[model samples]
Target: MAEDAHGGAEDANVRGTPPGGRGSHISRDHAAGPGARGADDPKRMEGGVLVSIGALLLGMLLAALDQTIVSTALPTIVSDLGGLDHLSWVVTAYLLASTAATPLWGKLGDQYGRKKLFQVAVVIFLIGSALCGMAQDMPQLIAFRAVQGLGGGGLIVLSMAIVGDLVPPRERGRYQGLFGAVFGATSVLGPLLGGLFTEHLSWRWVFYINLPVGIVALAVIAGVLHIPVRSTRHTIDYLGTFLIAAVATCLVLVASLGGNTWAWGSPRIIGLAVLGAVLTVAFVAVERRAAEPVLPLKLFGIRTFTLAAVISFVVGFAMFGAMTYLPTFLQVVQGVSPTMSGVHMLPMVAGLLVSSTVSGQIVSRTGRWKVFPIAGTAVTALGLLLLHRLGVDSSTGEMSAYFLVFGLGLGLVMQVLVLIVQNAVSYEDLGVATSGATFFRSIGASFGVAVFGSVFAGRLSDRLTDVLRGQELPPGLGADALKSDPKIISELPAALRPPVVEAYATSITDVFLYAAPVALVGFVLAWFLREDRLRGSVTAPDATQTLASNPVERSSYDEVCRALSVLGTREGRRQIYEKITARAGYDLLPAASWLLLRIRRHGWAEPTALSEHSGVPLRVVIEAARQVEERGLALREGHDLVLTEKGCGVAEELAGAREESLAELLGDWWGPDRPTDLVRLVAELNSELCGSDAEQPYEESVPRPAGRVRPGR
Candidate 1:
């Protein structure tokens, strides 16, 4: 069973119970969005969402940092561990474990609950990090890195799934944009920090650093992150998961081992290839029959989902392939220290930050997201081709420019694809869809690195052999020694250095030149993506079963449903109210009612904030404030709006009036038996309606109980 997006929980104001009184007792009817939190959920109304997001970003930082931070330190690790043959395994192990675990985490989160699962993931990640730091050999490190990847996979997927739980779809872009920025920031920070640790301290510090941050993130999530959950028995698809994992592992192993550890036509490589293909076919068959498939085959039927998943794969391929090798080229060929190489990568990070932040804001404002992916992938292809132009003597400025273009293209594509997939699915499928897309991207990264590693190694080997063929070798060293490590070339005879460095530079460029077409495929795929209309809210109509369970209420509740649906989301809900008022021959106070409820639920922040969040025009909100003041319903004490005793009575009357009017409209269908849980329905109704699920404005608002907290207090 798919868990509720917001998890399990009832509300304090769920019944007509006043503050400090017992909440209405009721059975679970429908899952409420995070915005639907009652007065009972501690801190929901008082900057809790922002606080929770802050903690999530820290978790995201840890995951992203680990992926790239180890890049610059890899050479040093190889030198220390003396396992040049197992170098790729260090990265491959993590990617393989992470790829296999991604879908399972999402499925388990749905079956159980996200909060506990996410917390467990954090603990596991921290434990793995400590183990990695303690590892004394290559095999130990690889095994520990696999452990880290297991937890890392959950960190990436669950953090995104959690956002779906808290924010509605309409408001998701803004937060997604922020998350993009966080990813970008960590990308830059990771390399720089890794370089610093490897250069000034021990490379082991790279893993140890996760301890403090992970602890803080865990504490924050455990204490501040409240997800009410109800568990039901689930048919876990172990067979399907195993088949998919097998397919991914086999394919990645082929890419990593073929042409490197063994000949391309070797029996081991050929058998693995055939096995992977057969497993893929079997996996598809398994998914078609599984009660709850790990990766739902139905998702493939969605055109946008399929297209976005492919594009995500291509982007990941190009991105990881380029990022993994660029620092090596800079540090070895350019003769820069690890720290300087990380600093030099700043141009790319800057481009990414600017493009991602700007594009996200544009998407939020305009909702025209399709153009970005098309244009971004095209630019990414161009950037890769430009990188192919670099030679051994290329200037730092030239390299930075190429990297900048690449980063811009990457930034534009990455976040939007996730948004596209999320927007395309229902809330129940949010976790699955999210992890599926991530799984494909991760699989792509694994293969891209493996394939490109093969290409780079082959090209570099051929060039090195060509250059060193007739030359006299040193007494103890041979050509194969240079193939194992780049640092060996730096330590070679001065006369032999230029040719080897030039060969490496040429090979790196060759890798990019060949990889360009992969991004081009993404550009082409972007054109086929259908632009589904972006929703104004994230409410999944089917997720809540309240109306569906009540046949009469379900049939007659259309107008009420329509009214409640737009309660706090859109500006056009006013028209729905106008129609409601017309039928009852009563004036409807849409603005006043919304404002009063806003004040009641979250207390006061600012008039302008309410306008922005509620989607009402600022002038309309200001005028509504005036009308409420004139009616003695509210008074502006300084910047804060307070409801007096008389105002509270009027507010109650307005609330009662709206409910009575709605009930009367359905009176015939409802008959004399009013729903016993009208309060829960209203709360759920308004919860679905409220814009509280929307992203908070840039200027943080700390709301307190209106008029309850004295100025001195």
Candidate 2:
């Protein structure tokens, strides 16, 4: 790792939680998006959580299933069209259209509605599948495949981003398990189904199979995914779209042709690569200037987004690119049938599913995703090195064991990165940020696959050339066929077999050896990922849940959810403190108390900052400070937010109970745009609850009970 990166992680907030306490619970339901409850009523909030889970499952399926489904069918499709050499295109075309379009799709989902756009994607995917089934040849099939990519691209990102939108990262882990399950099941199952269709039916059934499942998924999503609709319109970034697509296509083309179809020094390859670089630079410039930029350039300035994006790109390059070729090696080199290859590939899928699900749940409960990724990336690097050492003679057990290790590493890190990235942004930016990560991953994965395929093919050809030069090769035995299949090389003239098989093994191993440096990139990024508490207390529509009734739960939930917000994280807590104080009149203690309580409940800070922050009179601040110290909650250490272990627990519980008291005191303060006076009044009520004097202007509320020092006392 770079020295700079080490410093960055230290400065960054990626340290996981501070020993104890979880993420503040906030209502992640963004109004006017997919699966939102239009009302902030309690019944609706409860209903929304239940109904939305089912819908999210359906959406996740769209993303995960699409990625794994086409692999088994690729070889068969190539066979039928007599274009085995161009087989990588099947996956490339899908990734190309999907990745390039990801940002646009996410933006539209936020603008229109997640449900509406998601529904549209499902329809589009089904249509593309239908067209693919009817294709007469390769070109037609490729065109239709691009359509499928469009829908598939949005599937994973939208679902994940929405989870970040609605659920706090800490609590979000449990549900994220569902996404892991879908990905794992699909990865294992897709190949088996694809193989069956290729072997028993036709290669076309792989595409056709999506129709029935697609309909069921669409129905589930349309009915259950409910978000509020903003009555506003947004201008689409057509120019941004054109630029991104152009750059993506050129880069993909260059990677695809680099060593296979054309030499690196060839004009076609050089020109395409240059064009891609220029277009990419132009796209960045356009994004920086666009009014409603398809990619939000500002998001990159944030620490979490930057690290998450880099990690996603590396994962795309290492995992996606490398996995794309696993089946080929099994079938062509080892003489394993397609069906057998699917069975052999199950260990990786199994490992990923188990690890991701557990990691997600642990993250939700502890809000410590930073730790898992660290462990995961380290393991993944080790697994890649092991896999690289495998030769043609390596047994199935050895390869499968290596696959398991790699899968386990991948499972731990993949979805958790998405979880953290999604949590760092506000609901409004959730879709855009998520789509950005997904878009980059798609690009990286596509480029990786193309590059590896070209490199492997070229190395094999070169190796074969050297071997053939000294051999009395049969007049009809061509190097092209032998280079592609180790089994074919094994069947060649006995004297030539050893050198030929060795060449194939070397070519394959070189891909991993080259990719090791690339895989380490994610490891470095992992160190800088933020360790903010995922909010378990973020509630949007739960205002209607009785504040007086569940005061403890309400307070705690509110604290966890809003602490990050109250702390001036996006904007700065000091500013918000001043704003609330100014609006509340000169009763600084009361005003400060309200702000501090809000911040504490959000679990983003030590609650004691409230007393010091009151800036009321020293006497008034001291009294409250004494009360907190007596409770053994928070204490002052100069100006820093200092706390004992006991204090952290107190702060965590305080946030949990605060909501009920708040609901009872400020029953009328829930609206998108309420009077500023009401905001001031809520602050006053909050001050009273914490026994501070920063009351609202012209208020005569009952005072806090005296001599009530709650323990850890």
Candidate 3:
């Protein structure tokens, strides 16, 4: 379960709005206006929010789990359905449908409403799951998987978007971290779970298991999840989407069926190849003319984006290809059970998790990222070479060692690809560039699975035919039978089993051998990737949260908000207040400055309301209010506190100071040449930063007076 690159891209799509889009309204509502509602509003009830979030997480888990869970069960599935040649289609269909449908789901949710759409997605996913579990043949299963993937894509994109509606910007990072944790957990647990169900119950359980989880998620969402729907017109790139999907379909078909189902130079293969090329050209043309392109073609013009995309594709090609075939190798050739194969794969999973975490931390710390991708691709190539050496007689220790190496290599590169793409693009291209990077990785994964199947099938056929030629005396145990059902090898006579196992081993390992050079290509391209200074937002500690999840569809505003939220959290409250006050040239306590900014943001605030909303002690808030009033910075009108003329000037100065500080942290991203959307984003974020009570000064920072002589100051 190499990280689902699709998740990262799709997550980005619906999380925020485009420059002049919904994000502007949200920022204005949350920050710049008197009508701004606090995230801690009593009407919302914290308990209900948590429950709703839990339901959303469950929905995301179902989508993500399916990506890796099926790997361990593929062997049993092919065995049950008897279509070894179509094994890759099971994975390819899901990926292809999900990838193509991701942007559409995001747009539809935006146009309609996410809550209802999310419910619809769940129902669709559950229906698809039921159909998959009940599938009687390989074609039916593959078709059902496509149905499942369509829903799965919606589940991933909308769940994240819905979180944006439920929580304020300040808390988004913390919750997105939860989503990242889900992806991380699934990466390790999916294969294991699939193995457990396939071994203990049946392979069908892998699909059936989604029914209960999806049902609960659907019910909870329908019952409790409520968010305002702001209808916006969107011109979806329908022609572009169709052309690109057709292009991918044609290419995948050409790769998967070219050598096995049809000859490489045969009419069908040639027609697919020619059709893919024509569709690709047509897709490019349509993208140029589309009002809102699915993937902007201009992204390819940037050197860093292009290079990162190439590396991402190659990484996906190697990672998924290996993940898909490794289980078959262990179960068929090494004679390990489904569950044991999953257990044995843990070394690789552990290696990937460790390396991904370590690499992300290092990048966050130093702001230097080129080294990881370069080293990762190189090690990946080396790891694949190591895996190619695995054989039927290979020791468990040796096999584990190779798997760990491959996983480490993959981990080192996976997270950095998105960061570099984000850094390389301008604010305008930020959302698309992020999505584009992961999109290529996903497409690469589809191609990898398809290509590997083609190679494995072709090689296994030739090897099995050569080894078992003229020696099969059994009734129904033919070469095709052995290919269709690997279980038959165990039933083969003792003398014939050795050569047959050798055939399977050589065919599977040869896939790794062929893939090693592809990884090497990534290693070479890695050298060409431009090294750029990481943006403060991109290098924030919680940045990994953004990268680890399924991030496919998000807007530039949401992307920036999430990153800046992490940056704001990382920079403690006291320090941030101190910096703003210093920059504003105000000689006041940080708490007083915080109070002025908050009052300015909401137009008016009562000291009691401020104390209650922000977790600061009432005494401390009254004291700060006293100080501001003493300075004539704010005036008391009945029970509400409003900034005076001078206080308004000071608050504006402080707001400007906060914006400047944020801009400085963004490096070159902020400046005279900065995009208008970015300028708006920084302003909105400044308001959000002040609006959030989570960043209020600690209770210990301002102690209560020994004498409690103040009722209303």
Specify the highest-lDDT model's number: 3
Q: Give the TM-score of candidate 2.
A: 0.63
lDDT measured at residue 246 in model 3 versus the true structure, 0 to 100: 90
lDDT of 2 by residue, 82-171 (tens): 444455667778878776666566567667776677778778888988998998787788788888887776665466545545543223
Ranking by lDDT: 3, 1, 2
Identify the superior model by lDDT, candidate 2 or candidate 3.
Answer: 3
Against the reference, the lDDT scores of all candidates come to 0.66, 0.59, 0.81
Q: Write the per-residue lDDT of candidate 3 for residues 192-288, one digit (tens) a residue.
A: 9989999999999999999999999988888888788978689998889888889989999999999899999999999999989999989988999
lDDT of 3 at 378: 95
**Tens-digit lDDT track of model 1 for 1-713:** 01111312332342253222111222112112336545544344336777888888888778778887887787677667756546666776777776677667766786799888889889889999999999999989989999998898788667766765665333344455465566656777878998899889998999999999999999999999876574646788889978987897898788777887789999999999999999999999999999888888989988889998898788778877777778778877888877777888888777766776567556645657899999899999999999899877889889899989998998787657765776686544554675566667777777787777788877877888998988887753456777665677756778989998898899888999999999999999999998876544322222011100000001112212332333333434554343333343434255554565445433342577556544556776775577567666577767656665655554454445545544443323334554444434444543323313231111213221122211221
- How far is 548's C-alpha from truth in model 2 (Å)? 41
TM-score of each: 0.73, 0.63, 0.87
In the predicted model 1, the residue pairs found to clash are 8-228, 8-229, 169-538, 568-689
List candidate 3 segments past 4 Å from native. Answer: 1-44, 540-551, 595-649, 666-680, 698-713
Total colliding residue pairs, candidate 3: 19
Pick by TM-score: 1 or 2, better one: 1
Instruction: Report the C-alpha displacement of residue 204, candidate 1, in angstroms.
Output: 2.0
